[model samples]
Target: MSRTTALDPLFTAVDTAAFTDRHLANLAAGTLAAVRVPDFLGNAACRAALSALDRLPTTDYDPGRVPTPIVRFGPALNDYRDQDGHLDAERYWRDAEAARVAWHRAALRPDPIAVSMGHLSAAWGAALAPATINGRAVFGGTLREINAGALIHYDDINREYPTGLFDQEVIAQLAFNVWVAVPPTGGATTVWRHRWEPADDHHRQAYGYRSETVEHCQHVTLTPKLGDGLLFNPANFHAVEPNPDGRRIAFAFFLGLTTTGQLITWS
Candidate 1:
């Protein structure tokens, strides 16, 4: 894709019954802001996943790194990154294995991750593969309870691991989230039309940026509903609003579109 001098409109959100190839393609190409599927997971399945949450081991992110009090289950590679931007392979793999065991033990009927991946694969007309490094598959999907909310941030694997972390090269990346539980009010996710710029560094705060970083950018906000699935490009600065009424939880992962037209996944 060549850079055109066109002033494209800021991206907007769409509600769809299914994840379609057009949705995936538009997201990667920056032509769409987000695609949302209401009730992507059946109500019974969502309840089952929520129930299984009790048996799974959940942890909080390091307070020093992430001031927000977000609770999480499953392993995310970003959490195991070293100061030098390299992965702490030993500890990451250890937790990865433990998480796998715990997930199986939870035995969530109609595994949320599996079902989400299946729908995505069907939409793309290709099987989704796990992102690998050194020929080892990386962990995919994480369950997060974000009642207190997340700070404004963006995610780009290329920038995070400049030398490369995955064996597969990614041209573009998108974030996927499926809500199993939601609060009565608040907990809306807002995605700005902004991507990180060098000058934005001045507004840095912990693992994210200050709201001022995107104050001037056009954006869209989506209030999550139980069993709703949302897909969007995380290269845009985004944040989650705090929900004080009830627990707001979701299963999340990243999808990267490779140069070979293949889709790969990871948490």
Candidate 2:
């Protein structure tokens, strides 16, 4: 699809005014919903970016342990090995962050048309107005070149978005992610479910949330196409399945409001 045609479905699905109203309502009720902005980047831009990415270095993954459960493949590294094979996670993350900053500066110039913040407030009202939802200070802004893969387990403890070490709350407030799908080759960024058995009878379960049977695991295959992009709640229980064929690129940011207000964070 042409760049012009790619943006049609996204604009059609979201009506700015109506979305704002619903956002306010959801904020009042304290219910979370995933908001998807499909085909965010136009076809022409996506093609150009993918071509550029092909010439760039491939992302590397860390072999050591990390706090999160998801796997990551990016140019950034969490640690590096010296001649003696020693590793330092802090230095690795710093170097990666620095490289990311430089790359972003170069990519955002000359032709800066990759991501959009159109549905930020409407889809992520609470993230935008944290003061209303919780009595605390909130911050909002954007970060560039930091790509990540995350997995949110329902049973994990101390997984607060805004306050933990990672500051998920801040991340959400920024509305950091932008997505693009390229050509006949389906890129990485697939979401999947791990094979697991049903919990014991004593384990309690909540509605809309159930354990999956080991033998009945489900996998949703997302193919990269001319007019396909997905935006959803970042805090939702999901995973960024790797791109198997071509390269699939997405951008992410954070959005925040005061404690008394609502915050809105979406893809």
Number of the top candidate by lDDT? 1
Write candidate 2's Cα lDDT for 1-267 as tens digits: 211212212111221222353543342332423333345556676566555654334443332443322222232211244444443445655555554555565464223222344444445432243221133222222222212333322211122321232223332222234444443453433222331224522332321123332113322334434434333332233344333344345544333432435453321
| Model 1 lDDT tens row, 146-236 | 9888999999999998889999999999999999999999999999888998999999999999987877677889999999999999999
- TM per prediction: 0.96, 0.46
Off by over 4 Å in 2: 1-33, 54-58, 64-93, 109-115, 118-176, 183-229, 240-244, 254-267
Local distance difference test, each candidate? 0.93, 0.35
Regions of candidate 1 where Cα sits further than 4 Å from its true position:
1-10
Q: Superposing all C-alpha atoms, what RMSD in Å does each candidate have to the true structure? A: 3.5, 11.5
The per-residue C-alpha lDDT of model 2 at residue 39 equals 57
Which candidate leads the pack in TM-score? 1
